[model samples]
Target: MRRVLAELALGVRLAFAGGRRGWLRTAMATLGVGIGAAGLLLAASVPTMLDGRQARTDARYDSPGGVTVPAGRTTILAGPDGQSGDNAIRARLLWPEAPGAPLPPGVPAFPGDHQMYVSPALRAALDGPDGDTLRRQMPYEIVGTIAPAGLSGPHEYAYYAGYQRATALVEQQVAWRVDRFGYPSLDVEAGAGGTYVIVAVLVATLLLPVAIFIGAALRFGGDSRDRRLAAIRLIGADSRAVLRMAIGESLVPAGLGLLLGLLFYLLIRGQVERFWLFDVSVYSADVRPVPSLAVLAVAVILGLSAGVTLLGFRGVTVEPLGVLRQAPTWRGRLWWRLIAPAASLLLLYPVLLGRENVGEARTGIGAVLLIVALIPLLPYVVPVVARLLPDGTASWQLASQQLRRNPSSSTRAVSGIVVAVAGAIALQSLFGAAEVERSIPYDKADPAFLLQARDRTSTDAMKQRSARFEQVSGVRAGTVALYTIYQKDIIGLANLYIGDCRSLSQLATLTGGCEPGDTFTAGSAEKVITIDKGEINPAPGVRLAVPAKARKATLIGSNAQGVASAVLMTTIPAQLARVEPGFVETRMFTDEKPAVVAGKLRGVAAEIDPLAMFTAMAPEGDRFGPLRVALNVGSTLILLMMAVGLLLDVAARLHERRRILGVLAAVGARDGTVIWSVLLQVIVPVAAGLSLAVGAGTGIGALLMRLSQVPVIFTAGTVLLPVAAGAGLVLITTVAVLLPAVRRVTRTEELRYE
Candidate 1:
């Protein structure tokens, strides 16, 4: 114990000395780790929080009496190819039956006869020249149920109404109020769910890898102190004592770092939480870490592990006599070539085979595999490439030869570069691919004018304008469809005006190029109107037994993501003839650019605005805001670290080979030659490393494309731009770190041993 304590004291002193000497480098490394840890924590925390909240919300729906929805409203979504010519469907608010029970689907059941529910079929025949059911034998699924007198009332005589009546209520609600235009809303009642373990797991996952990285960086200082360790060894301190000292060295600082990291995490937690895109408020209240107690313990263990491991390694392989005789050339097993390639291949194969559900696992596997393959191979490759450079001017030649002779030094030099290049290339690839997929084709379909109305006053004017506009332009007259929103009652429904039956055939082509006069056939007197996926009553592809007298309709199509907007595509005359006294009209289709007619529509309130309302589109120039900042900051720090590592290796080599470089200086080699040789050596290996990084980045993007629902395209700018930036960063970092060291060597006196 006494011996161990003494070693601990010595280690603590040495660790401080190292920190004091290398404060800048140490701080930079710590910052790098902190940022990475924070980012990871934030990412993990968001998804965890969202999933946790969703789970709790889902549990609330499993309560005793079951959930309650609006009364008389059945069928969650309209089916594709369903009955048309009736009124439109609207979204409704849900009310739960019991604490845990889900809200049933239907019209809101207020206890009173003051509200009237009417079928949409009542006005269908009056509105158009045709009306019919597309199908006759379709069953209805209950979407929502209503209980009278709220949850407190006793059972009373209750009546159920048809979809037509329900739709009428929905229309009234929208027509009487403006709330129908509000963004969709979702509310949940959470029960006594357990503490959020998901948050803990997420935060831990984010921090753990960072902790491991910190541990690794901490190991570097521990390794550097081995020379001092040998001194103690020579002074009759046993190998175990030296090991203890190393352990003590790493633990003390790592403990400090752990403390700092935790504090940083806490300090930024609030800001981080807001931007997390997930709700983790539950975790913030639940998870409370003990004041550095766990961190201290972990630090101590890591220190001991690192110290003992390195001590054991030295005991087995490092000879004191060899150290005393001359500085040792860095040694590594050459078999890493075989091991790295094989392991990399193995790691990559799984990623290729991984399914969508296992995506995160595949990413983890790929990252691990790449690290394993890259780190070991870098040392060997760096040296061979360095050696192959032309041996010229004295400084360059000295730098090159010095690098060639020191494998450990080269490894350090390239570490930061590898990390920086990898990140830059990766981000470049991802964003580039995303951009390609997102940019809409320039010649997209446009709406000439959209007319919005609060009631029937604008329908006739809209119909007249539709005809006059087509006649004046000498183009085929476009169909005039009516759209309305009713909000005068307890329920709300959006209505569409389905125009000429022929326009129905062009529905699929609306998103692209189509012949204008395709015909859509409806059975009997009803015109078959195909609704946009979002505008459909029920979900697409299901049959709906709408109350259209004897006719039935089936849902034929649907948009995958929800409604962009509600649309009605029917004849103007048909729509006008059936207009309700109170309804809103809106139009959204045209071939003419609204910008050209902006002056013409300035005085017209009913003129449809040509600009599509995009709720989430970013403005110009800021498209790369957060992503660019993150990518650049992360890349800069890592690449800079890598550059520093290289310089450190070069410095160490220069220090060890002072005699060799001095002899070369005496041999008449020019300073320029020396400089070139050194730069060339660095340039060669780095180039190879860069190539590998670029290749890996390209491959990762391709893999993402294969795995994602959206296509991930590879563009020249995405691939090349980041690579160029990486190369530039390498040049800058190398020059910044090495110039002083290089200059000092050139000016310093050559050593002579006679």
Candidate 2:
């Protein structure tokens, strides 16, 4: 034990204070390990982020369920959820049944009628420049901020306004009576499963690349390290001593890397709070790394570093004179390379067999296995590509010769890129395929939109609002329509549409040229509506009597607002002179960007009616907006990180070859030839790796979709994105990073230093 510790301690000292060469090795190893550790650390925080947010939200669950708790002195009534601009407002107007009622989570006491408790995010929004609209909508003074214990996330917009009366709220049926704030934990609704699946795919996409890159990072400068070990052997050190020293050196940097990863994750977490991806954002506090996974991540990184170092010495013997490299016999074995492809097929058998209702776990497993399968085969593939290259210029031959002589580092450096591109592509394919399952009723990009007031408001008020919307830019046309219950000397209820002749014509087929006060009834009205006399009440201050001579019209079509109904009554202002019609719907067609138009409309509505909501009226549109957002955002980030690794790895490989480059310049090779030679050296392997990744990614993605019971969509954008990105990285590295090193190595000073 002492002998081993002494050797390990010696290596640690040498790594820290072991001259420039030792520092380079440490940098290479530390950077590679740290990047991977950071990815896994971030992935590990997912459960904490989700579960913690869910738990806090659950604690304050006040929605009225199937069973209502009878109101008492300890009970409170809460409700009237609405929105201000784009921010969703959980409007909680609490009316305590008696004094000293049990307060909601995070509230210290019951607020006065004019005061309310707002979440931190809501408070910030209220204080911002855009708060004018929100302030008018809520019309309450802020008394306190909701504590973190009562909120779902840091950026959630919510408020608890105090009201003295529960009478109005209860009658409206929007308010729920509850004696307590929280209920028992229940399973997440099925609607949330898509988000979970997206998360699982994202993790799988990142982990495989991270794992491959870490291995590549470890092998960045393996050649120099092996020679150093041989030199240590020449100094009377036994093989066991050398092995322990190597492990110690690898371990020290790997450990420092863990600290560096933690630092990186913390810095990133802070920046993430400033922005949201696909409506998904987390507070720095909520994103705590799971303790068990954090520990496991640390262990895996350290273990892999030591394990890779140990493997580096497996087939090679270090002698006093020099190191004898005994290459592995399986390096050229076609049989071994085929195993990866075969394994991938086995993992995807269920999907390939056209099985239905395959689990999400299988989709995730296939994505991982597909990317990982390419790694082992990369070593075998690179050499074959080199030998098969067409004979061309001297630079080509030189690049090929180098690849044939030493393909290990080239293979390792390209592995990360291969796995990352492939995995992201596969994940995207799953997204495309699974997207079919969402029952998007309308076109997502359609400019047609509608605004419906949650509360009952007059048709005149709705027409004024619609006319105001027309004045706003991008709104080509605006039509106001109302859907209400039509009852007159009737025992039962029937659907009714009240609109002008021009607006009513768009919804149903009329018998004659429509005019104001012209009442028409649909063919279905006689069957569903009864003729018996009964007292009917529709809206306050509004009474209706069906016209004595109503014409029959055919129901032709429906508008964006779904206004096609059994009874069509074009009532002029004179018939219901005092009626303030509730249930008003307005449709708008926009010529500008729908989102921008929607936001403007929201601002417009806040001033007119606070309870109004602007919803896109696309019948064939994207219903799962959030799921697609989180998926694409996560996939984009993972690919970018992988590209960074490739840049550093290639730069290191070029810098390490400065000696050989200097020799070529000393002999008579031009700068162009030397640069091109180095370019080919990296590009050959990179091109081959990228080709394999694209093929595997596409195949895996199709398989993933099949397994998940979704249509297989082969999108060119998703497949080619990684390829273009990888190719761009190589060119950028060659022109920017590698070109400088190549020029510097061409000088005589580079030769003199060695």
lDDT by residue (1-754, candidate 1, tens digit) is 8877887887767666755445543553354345444443444454444554444334322222223334332322111111121111111222222233222222353212212221222223223343222111112223233332111111111122232222333333321111111122254433111112112222232233333344345544433455566666777777677677766765555545545655666776544322311111333432233435444444444454465347434732356444444464566577856675566556557556654444344354554455445555777777676667676555555556656665554455564455455545555565565454433222233233333333443435555544543432322233334333322231333334344433332232333222322222222212332222323243222111222322222112321123222333333333344443222322223333333222223222212321111111111122333444555555555554545544554555545555655555676655566556556656766777777767765665565445433355777777777667657765665566556665566543746443
Backbone clash count, each prediction separately: 88, 10
TM-score of 1: 0.60
Give the per-residue lDDT of model 2 (tens digit) for 1-754: 9988999998788565436645765775676677778877987898988887777778888754657666675455655435544356677778788665667888888888868999888899888986775576677889999987877766678888886665465655545677777876555534332334445555656666667666666665566666667678767787888888888767777888888888888887887666554334577787788999989988889888888887776533434353423232234667876776776677667767876555656655655666667887777778789898798998888888778877776666667667767766777666665554432214432335666664444446545666787887867543444544555444433456667676566556788778878888864455333222222354323345567677877654244233333677675445343433345666666655454455556566656654455565532233334545655575466556555655666666666667677888889889989888878887888788888888887877776565444567787877887688767765675577766666787775667653
Q: Could you tell me every candidate's TM-score relative to the true structure?
A: 0.60, 0.78
Best by lDDT: 2
Q: In candidate 2, which residue pairs get closer than 3 Å at backbone N, Cα or C atoms, i.e. clash?
A: 441-619, 441-620, 442-618, 442-619, 442-620, 442-621, 443-620, 443-621, 444-621, 457-582
RMSD of 2: 6.0
Which window of ten consecutive residues has the lowest lDDT sum in model 2?
A: 527-536
RMSD of 1: 14.0
Q: What is the C-alpha RMSD of each candidate to the true structure, in Å?
A: 14.0, 6.0
